[model samples]
Target: MKKKITVKLDIQKIVRITGNHGGYETGECLLCEASGWLEGEFGSPYSTKDTGADLVHKKNCLMNKVLA
Candidate 1:
């Protein structure tokens, strides 16, 4: 039997890397007031690729814990 490898999503790291790039209305890089946890111009910063969505969040937002 073959085992499947899973990669955990790093919210903090992604936030750090994409800092300020995503368009947030708060005028602050970290603070976002969009419907989702994080707001970006095209899609979620953590997105594997651009999808043209205005806002996006992971199934579970780990970054919120870090921010709070």
Candidate 2:
């Protein structure tokens, strides 16, 4: 019999921002201020839908790494 090993990724600490902030003008990580392609497309500190910003932060934000 062969045993299958599974690895668990900790995602409990990941925070998703989904609000409109008057001060938010760039699509950057609110915690680390890291900017990505989403920022270029949607402008920095975006106030609209945050799905793109969330994706970018999850992929490249230093804050996400630290939290994880």
Candidate 3:
């Protein structure tokens, strides 16, 4: 069996991330930012994560019912 991996978050990281892409117009999650989502970006594009299977991963997510 394989263990599940998760995205990590921190205060400084969040501040830096949000500061970089806080107003993308999308309600995607910031804390659980996924890497390589953007084309040639390699890093998460504006911290708008599409991986919302977990609770934290769903933070600020557009599909996240909690946000909706």
Candidate 4:
């Protein structure tokens, strides 16, 4: 019998932005002030939906509703 090994990848969570440039009059994320709001709040531009402006990546907020 062969033993299988599983590897765990160590990766940090980095919020990603997917907003269109020149789309909004103001080029800034009101939710997280990350400069990108159109993008889904998750893993470069995290939004307040996850954490408030006071805390981002520093503290985890259960406000991000990925599907909703």
- Local distance difference test, each candidate: 0.39, 0.42, 0.33, 0.34
Candidate 1 segments whose C-alpha is farther than 4 A from its true place: 17-68
Instruction: Enumerate clash totals for all models, in the order shown.
Output: 0, 6, 0, 7
The all-Cα superposition gives candidate 2 an RMSD in Å to the true structure of: 10.0
Q: Encode model 1's per-residue lDDT on 1-68: one tens digit a residue.
A: 99998656554434432344354431222334223323433235334343444344343554344433
Residue lDDT tens for model 2, 1-68? 99998645433333333444574433445544544433333233332355643434434444434443
**Model 3: per-residue Cα lDDT over 1-68, one tens digit each:** 99998654433333222222443322223445532222221233334444532123334432233222
Cα deviation of 40, candidate 4, in Å: 6.9
Using Cα atoms with residue i matched to residue i, what is each candidate's TM-score against the true structure? Answer: 0.25, 0.21, 0.18, 0.18
lDDT of 2: 0.42
Better of 3 and 4 by lDDT: 4
Q: What number of backbone clashes does candidate 2 have, counting pairs of residues 3 or more apart or in separate chains?
A: 6
Highest-TM-score candidate = 1
Worst 10 residues of 2 by lDDT: 39-48
Of 1 and 4, the candidate ahead on TM-score is: 1
